[model samples]
Target: MYAWAARWRNAQRPKDQRLRDAERSGRPPDQRDQITQKLTALMSTTPTAHGYRHPNWTTPLLVAHLAREHQLEVSARTVRRALHGLGYRWKRPRFVLSRRDPNLRQAKGSSRGD
Candidate 1:
């Protein structure tokens, strides 16, 4: 295949040249450490502090905030992956009425004498 041919050709190159990859230009890899540090700092505060309506941080919201404030454009999935790599876990808060409040709504709706 062409790959084998290219490998053989590359083998014939000077040792110094073969040791280094050919020069190329394109977007580089994401800065995981920077993202992690940002996330850690951001997590210490509520989203409202950053002018977000929601109090908690979501992947999409994080992505948007990073793009708008930090000028770092990345996908929600990227943020999610970074969070996972940082050992962050996501948990949804549960809202429920207390067991002693079962009839609290009815009592509040009815008059004290009735």
Candidate 2:
């Protein structure tokens, strides 16, 4: 296009600016920073404290909570992205054996024919 040619011809423009398309008018800001902040705070507390049955927080639960409390309409994907940006990683809960008996580990292994 002529516009692209003209833009490339301008020697005064920064090299980085040429690598991407120019910013244009678009949708209004989604206030992601504020939502991220709220999510951070919410992470500190359990869902039960907020009248939810589940103890852990899920993406859908977070989205519903935001809609209910902050009246913010955002997708679970957005919440996940924000969580990723905040350096949060998803880890499944692991089953932990109770320390009821000191020889429980030995008994378990022996019974399994190991």
Candidate 3:
């Protein structure tokens, strides 16, 4: 309860530092489309030094990675927006559960269940 109260108090305080930091940057941000295009071309043909490690930096992978890695600058939501503009949709394999198998997610449990 103490920790929760402390977190709640912190959340109530306005984000002054973040606003100041943004003002300090003093420039408009780069366009994601341009960045995506550049990153896509570079990854598709060019052999980057880091390419050995980041081999699967394709268009989708690039978006996904940026969405994960540079989360502050590039979020998964923004990546989804970009992908949608490029006529792409996020799809992951869904498990085909047996009819008898119960869904654990729908089960009632405490927050500590995971």
Candidate 4:
């Protein structure tokens, strides 16, 4: 608590000498606006059109596609993060019983002893 108070007081000192967050030193922020736009556009279309054998875009598949098409080398995790940042979400394909026997319900009902 005392240390925190001292640090707070120091931060409140003269503006020039005041404590401030240190400049971040590392790989610069990934600003891939063009890539994000292309990704979103790709999402709007079927993956098949983009030469992907499958119809949906998985993170790994997207990563590979971006590398092949845009020459961008990125990880599947990075692709997923970028997609989420772009307000996109992953969706699983929904499966429904396409063909059902008309008498299936009746047959099940008759099979139940109760």
Candidate 5:
């Protein structure tokens, strides 16, 4: 249809006369790169190392940290999307109690009736 006709018309034009891709219209590209680099650098280390009281990173915490440390304002959802694009995955930390107490099982059993 229209596309075929347009392609046929384009084929007839000289190589240099052909239409080029439209320039992207939006925020400048460098801003995105700067944000991405800052995010990646932040992710490479623990929050505590950066003077954040938290032991690990959360989406909201990351947003606040970015604004505070890097002066980059972004939303938690944006942070999550950036993290996803960078191939990072979130997993919960596992906690296991050590078997240092011999009476641990007995104490738990005794408490069950209450």
Candidate 6:
């Protein structure tokens, strides 16, 4: 009943509907904050749930998994959200190719000279 009433009131208003906007982008300030918090928590812990130890994924890996496997519109931004929500504390290198930067790259190259 309250939801219907609120919707009716919003419908009467001519300007952008606050309630509708809230529903889409998360609104009511408080509710959005709460949901963001929840989503953040979920994102942080989702990896562990899926047996993944890392908090973030490489661009290609993320695209293939989130977009293709999970079928979610989980762009980098969304991934950030999940990380933020989860309060993730770990980070793994992405594209840290040994050839790209000698100083950073530490791939399994040939054994160092004795």
Q: Which pairs in model 4 have colliding backbones?
A: none
Candidate with the larger TM-score of 2 and 3? 2
Tell me the spans in candidate 2 whose CA falls farther than 4 Å from its real position: 1-26, 101-114
Count of clashing residue pairs in every prediction: 0, 0, 0, 0, 0, 4
Give candidates' CA RMSD values in order. 6.1, 9.5, 23.1, 10.0, 7.6, 13.3
lDDT of 6 by residue, 5-99 (tens): 67767756765564444536655343335445544444455454756675654444454455554455545665555556556544665585454
**Lowest-lDDT window of 10 residues in candidate 4?**
105-114
Name the better of 2 and 4 by lDDT: 2
lDDT: which candidate is best? 2
Which pairs of residues collide in model 6? 40-85, 40-86, 41-85, 44-86
lDDT, candidate 1, residue 68?
A: 90
Instruction: Estimate the TM-score for candidate 4.
Output: 0.57
Give lDDT tens digits, candidate 5, residues 1-114.
Answer: 686557557877766655554478877554567778988898899999988898888999888888987888888878888889899898897787877877545555565565
lDDT-wise, the better of 1 and 3 is 1
**Candidate 3 per-residue lDDT over residues 4-89, each given as its tens digit:** 55655675557553223233656777577665664445445533444435433344556554545454355556655665666655
Cα lDDT listed for each candidate? 0.83, 0.87, 0.53, 0.78, 0.80, 0.53
Residue 93 Cα positional deviation in candidate 2, in Å, after optimal superposition: 1.4
Best by TM-score: 2
Q: Where does model 4 exceed 4 Å of error?
A: 1-31, 99-114
Q: How far off is residue 89 in model 2, in Å?
A: 0.7
Clash count (model 2, backbone only): 0
Residue 72, model 5: lDDT of: 84
lDDT per residue, candidate 2, 2-110, as tens digits?
8887878777878667546868989988879998899999998999999999979999999999999999999999999998988888999778886688654555545
Model 1 clash pairs are none
TM-score of each prediction: 0.61, 0.65, 0.31, 0.57, 0.58, 0.30
Candidate order by decreasing TM-score:
2, 1, 5, 4, 3, 6
Off by over 4 Å in 5: 1-30, 97-114
